[model samples]
Target chain A: MSRGTLALCAAGLLAAILYPLVVRGLAGAGVGVSANYLINVGMLVFFVAFIGQSWNIAGGFAGQTSFGHVVFFGTGAYCSTILHVTHGWNPWLAWPVATAAGALVGWAIGALAFRAGLKGSYFALITLAFAEVFRILANSVEFTRGGLGMLIKADQRPENFQFRDPMWIYYLALALCVVSLAIAWQLTRGRFGARLVAIRENEDAARALGIDVYTEKVKVLALSGAMCAAGGTFYAQKYLYIDPSIAFGVDKSVEMLLVSMVGGAGTVFGPLVGSLVLTAINEGTRSLASVVPALKNVQPLSLIVYGAMLILIVARLPDGLMGLFGRRKSGKRHDA
Target chain B: MLEVRGLSKAFGGLKAVDDATLDVRQGEIVALIGPNGAGKTTLFAAIAGFHTPDAGRVTLEGHDITGLAPHRICAAGMVRTFQITQPFAKIDVRENVMVGAWLRTGERAEAMRRAEAVARQVGMGDQLDQLGADLTVAGRKRLELARALATGPKLLLLDEVMAGLNPTEIAEIVDVIRAIRDSGVTILLIEHVMQAVTSLAEQVYVLNQGRMISHGTPAEIAADPAVVEAYLGHGAAARLARGAAHA
Candidate 1:
């Protein structure tokens, strides 16, 4: 890794370690800070970063844009939730099952899509369609409890992957975010990573150079799916709820794309940077409604602001925040 | 060694390559020459397994490799370069070559060493860190050749490697091609540059409208009446014959 990337990673690590302490210190003081609010924001940032980093494996490095990543996310959420609630399995023990389920689905998608020669927007649409199908199935399925959503009882047990304090959840998310970042870092450094970038740049030339494009793509997709599913398990444990709309919604897929793209899609640190920026924007806009009485009635004003910011970022800084730092010297052809 | 037999490819009603047959021995530079849209690239695609032939067989070192994937064909020791250079525009020159080198070895250090050596072999040693999009047209062509060479192919198919190069650049690439052939890599090149064909190729095959019109030594191909009538036109052939008579 370059000095810049190393420095970024170190800084991120320091911040993650210090974050809970800072929040606790403020709560101890007379700052009127809620531990729950701080934990909520931290969890959101970490989970978004994690899922975005997961999507980056295939979308950024391999240059395969998938609009249905929520399929894997939902798979993880459903698998872990179902196993834990129905089978009385420990959530920690069910984690791998969720990840495996995500990987299997990812492999199947890759096999079918690649064999059919789907690419570009066609691939994106097919993935999106699959997510929609899964969403509807989850809604209608008896095991999933239909559209009512499934909820885990409030059990503050370590073995259950649950905690009495939201701080524990925050710490868990932080650790997972760091691990995902490390994986992304390792991926971009090796031969496998080089092959992914090659396929991204030009599939035909990559194939001519003896890279198995399909296998490499499928491998990355499976890894990506597993990672995203792992994040989904974290989400289910943190929120204690899993619904079709919450787990497999198109909005969740869009959020992953936005986080990755807005931060710098291909870079390891891009998603984290994007997640922080986006969360800050979301929080900032929500606070605006209280400050401005005219905006108090507009519940989705934050979303409108979020959408506008995305457009502006996409148009002006196509490589995202990393481009502003000149870390994207290789150019923006693979930014998609 | 490579052999293409009765290769036929069609796009809807149009036969892009029709019954095209050719051969490249183990240690000679062979040239495939044709005018625009003569299916030279299509034929290369078939041999390289980018396009499945409607009817034919491709063999490498006597092993049947017909209808295989391009990567599989490459693994069988036949590698091809594109007519329009397709560089990994987002990667540096070294990594682009490294992708090909990784074909032979999974180790990063080994691939890096191989990539560097191949880059130097193709006269791109000085531009290892340059991005693919930043290279000049001639530089991109060299990168393409360097990438292919890094794959350690027994048979190399070069498609219009000298197309956009100036005479000086062409001469430089011709020297590289000769060096590669001297190193025991058989070359089957599709070239429009007559000087490159005449100087580099031990034998030449002429193609027109997806069919092999003639195959012979450069002098014999230059004097062939059918090649003259089909590709060179009567005017250029007469001029060529006059020049030949004087020489």
Candidate 2:
């Protein structure tokens, strides 16, 4: 990290810390016109960004490009939900176990796929297949409550991992986002990151250069899976309910992938920027639809715009939105 | 030191490499020369553990590394370069080399330092900041060598480092190879550039039709009729011999 980047990061951190407080003070809590909706939106952006960063770690940095990252996400959600609701385990305790389950699944999948010499599209398709399998299993399984889904009884206590104030959950999301940012930052400066980028660029070359490509890929997927699973736990805690569709949905997978891709897949701040854009579009379209009074739901309007924007991003900005800021110097920052 | 005993590899019905034997002594520079499709790259892959040999052994410093993974073979003190250069295209040259440097040292700073030193050794000192994709053909070739060299290998298997270089570039790389050998890394290179082979190789091995036909000093291998017959068909070799007599 350069002094400029360090200063930028510090400023961004300060801005994030102040955002909710500023919104509450300015708007004075209420409903649609107040800060409440914006606060929720802001919270959601951070949460999605957090999970998207998990996808970015393996898909963007390692070039694993998984289409089924929700497998880990759903796995995490179901593990914690099952343990907390069924086994009477504390959510806090269950979260870690859930995260571990995600990592183990990631490790197993990575070992199976890479060991079989699956590469490129094949590797991606297998992840999608795995996610579908998990989704189906969760749909039919006894402990998961099948299609009915499971819910945590409302116990609004900080110790119970539930919050009376939404601001607290928002802050938690912010903390997770910051930690993930640090992980990405760490990758940019370390040997592990270098090895991953090498594997991403050319696995055969990386192997010939004495990099254990298989181990590195497996390690990255494990790391990615853990981070994603943590997000799953956060999601369940926030919503208090996780059904089969919500937990293992392709929509969440696409959202995670889209945020990373649109922002800047490999960069630390990509998912954050992407989530902000997505939330902004959603709100912007919602307000526009309210004025028009004919739009059935604002979501379709936003989706059209989002779909168009995605095409533009893919066509013009291969490096995502971060490329616009001249962040191509991802290699020059080792001096820090 | 490296040794290969009757290494053979076949893909389905086509025997890509059959019963090939070669050796690189401690601090020696040997050349493997053959026509295109003479199974040179396949043999390099087989020895480097990219391809599993059917019935033979490869020993690096007297340990059997025949069917080990490519990374394990690289760690065991032999690293092979590709005939067609493969660089981390998005990463810069120094970082690309650092990927190999990370093999010995896990420290980022130390690996970067080693990568820089290797880059300089390959005459790529000024091009350190260039992206791997941005390099010219000769630059990519040098990048390949620098990357493999960063691993601190005992033996470097260079697959046509000069395949796409001009004469001057070829001479520079040849000098770089010599410097690498002098600095204590042995080399076993596959070359079509007979000049580089003659100038740099202490011993030359000729492979034809998935087999090693001859092995000797550069002059002796150049004079061998079997080597000529392998490169040119029997009719062409005889005709060339007759033409030489007529001349």
Candidate 3:
């Protein structure tokens, strides 16, 4: 590994270890509800980072933009919620089933799209359409209880994936974020990773060089879907409620894109960095609204800031926030 | 050994390659030459599995490989370089070659060693760390060859590898091609450089209007009246015949 990657990993590890302790310390120091609020924000950051990293496998590393990753997230959320609510199954045990369903769906999508030779914007649009379709199904399905959504009654039990304290949820999100980062790290280093980047660089050249482009793409998409679905389960467990609109909405897809792009696509730590920045901005805006009464009625303040940030990131730092750091002397070539 | 039989491809109403047949014997350097729009590249594309021929079959060592994927064709020990060099521009030269080397070995270190050796063989030893986008035209051409060579192909199809090079660079590439042939890889190259064709190709084939006009030794090809007409006008063909006789 390069020194830069090593440093990033070390920093990530330290933050993961220190985060829970800091939250607990604040609670002990009588910060009370504010400390819990901070824990909630931290958990959101970790969740966004996890989802962003999951999206990175296909979007950043493999150069296949998917505007419908929310399908995996929703599938996972619904799979676990329905199983737990309808069958009284343990949420912890149902988590893996949810993840597997996500992988299967992802594989099916990959096989169909790749076999049909879909790529680039067409691929993106198809995935988005699938998400929309899933959202509609979740809304109307009799078993899913339609638009009313599924709700799991909160109980103070680890087996149920429920806890009265927010720390357990925060820790779970943090652990998943680290795992996602580790997966991304391994991918960018090995032969499989190199082939993915090659495909991203030039699909024709990569094929001519003996790389099986279709299989590699399908594999990455499956892995990415599985990872994102796992995050969906965590979200459902923590929130105890999931509606189709909340789980499979286009807004969720855009958030994943924004997080990874803002951090740095294709870079190992890009998603984590992007998640941190975006989460801070979001929470900061909410605090600003609370402090200034005039901003309360305006609404869309966070959306405006997010739009401006995206413009700046796209226009100035095309490589994401990481591009502002040491400018590596690698060539940049975009085929599209 | 490679054999292409009755390969035909059409784009819309235009026949890009029409029932073309060719062969490359083991350890020999064969040249395919033609005027612009003669379908030399289209033929290469069909054989290399980039384009599925509307009608025909291709075989490597007698294994029928028609309509196979390009990567599968490559895995069968046949690889082709592009006329317009396409390198992974963001990656350094070694990594670009390593992408090909990874076909044979899974280990990064092993791929790196193979890539280094091929880069050195292609006279790009000193430019291992140079980004593909930063290379000169000649350097890019060498990188293209190096990448193909790293794949350990038994039959390498080179498309316009000698184009856009100075005489010195062209001569260097010719030497590299000879060395590649001597190392037991068969070469079927597409070239417009007549000099390189004469110096390097053991046998030469001429294409015109999607048809194989003639095939023979370089000297015979240079002296063929039909070949002369295909290149020069009717008046120049007679002049070339007289000039060939005088020589």
Which candidate leads the pack in TM-score?
2
Relative to the true structure, candidate 3 reaches a TM of 0.95
lDDT of 2 by residue, A275-309 (tens): 99998988889889888877856457988888998
TM-score of each: 0.95, 0.97, 0.95
Preferred candidate (TM-score higher): 1 or 2? 2
Name every residue pair that clashes in candidate 1: none
In TM-score terms, candidate 2 sits at 0.97
Better of 2 and 3 by lDDT: 2
Instruction: Give the range where candidate 2 chain B is weakest over 10 consecutive residues by summed lDDT.
Output: B231-240
Model 3: per-residue Cα lDDT over A105-144, one tens digit each: 8999999998899999999999999999999999999989
Error of 3 at A161 (Å): 1.3
For model 2, the local distance difference test gives: 0.91
Off by over 4 Å in 1: A328-336, B234-247
Top of the candidates by DockQ: 2
Q: How many backbone overlaps does candidate 3 show?
A: 0
> Which regions of candidate 3 fall more than 4 Å away from where they truly are?
A3-8, A30-33, A327-336, B242-247
Per-prediction DockQ, in order? 0.61, 0.71, 0.58
Interface RMSD of 2: 1.9
